[model samples]
Target: MKQVEVTLNVNGKDTTLTIPPRMTLVDCLRDELRLTGTHVGCEHGICGACSVFLDDEPIRSCLMFAVQAAGHRITTVEGLLNEDGSLSDLQDSFWECHAMQCGYCTPGMLVASESLLAENPDPSEDDIREAISGNLCRCTGYQQIVEAVQMTAKRRREGAANG
Candidate 1:
């Protein structure tokens, strides 16, 4: 297979690389771009472990081709950092709430939570549950993850009101 060139805007940086047409976006981001934050789980879309933001929408990178992602913006788990390199509010909430155990599902959970918060900053418990339903977590029984997202929502609302 001939390798093709593709450019992806990831984490606010433009990265150009040559990859096989069959390469998945997750592989491109991990193998070529050295952004290993996006983990590969089932390799099938069933496991959202390889989730990332494609143009600000959460998608399964393992199911997306590198060529298909050309000229699009991507945000891996690594991109969810504060400007000062500190953990973002969502990540902080996860930590404060003890949302992760083995942490395999954390990246996907974080992406899902972020997507929900982006669309609905003030989400109900049911809404949070629905948003994270796609991302499976074998640890913490999802209660901590829900609590983390709720905590993040509350903090974001409080911060917005204060500012």
Candidate 2:
């Protein structure tokens, strides 16, 4: 079996790994790096459960190969933590708003929401819906998720104004 070396900057850590060419990024993250936050569902990329950040952009890890991720910055849900290692503002908002159920899609939802918030700090309801369209949540009907993002945005704005 032929193997390839790929280097990925994950969660602010530099990691070099050797793996088979056919291995998917999701596999490398979960199997090798032990970042299980990125789930695997609908391996065809429709479920959006395996979403991760490639250079701050939400991408489906299951649809991408490990080799293709080389030299890229990957951020799994584990990376979304405050300096004190507690939940981030967005994560806290999710909890406060009860944005998760079963927790399978939470990670992907977080990634998608983070991407949206990064690009648009003050996202409208429609914007929040469109941002999470790719990630499927059969649990909360998505209303709570949208509310979570909205809450996070509001809190962030307040914090910025006060700080």
The candidate scoring highest on TM-score is 1
Clashing pairs in 1: none
For model 2, give the 10-residue run with minimal summed lDDT.
136-145
What tens-digit string does per-residue lDDT give for candidate 2 at 74-146?
9999999888899999999899988887888999999999999999989999999999999998675598889
Backbone clashes for every candidate come to: 0, 0
User: Candidate 1's residue-wise lDDT over 51-155, tens digit each?
Assistant: 999999999999999999988889989999999999999999999999999999999999999999999989999999999888888664599999999999999
lDDT of 2 at 107: 92
lDDT of 2: 0.91
Q: Candidate 1: deviation at residue 42, Å?
A: 0.6
True-structure RMSD, every candidate: 0.9, 1.0
- Give Cα-based local distance difference scores for all models: 0.92, 0.91
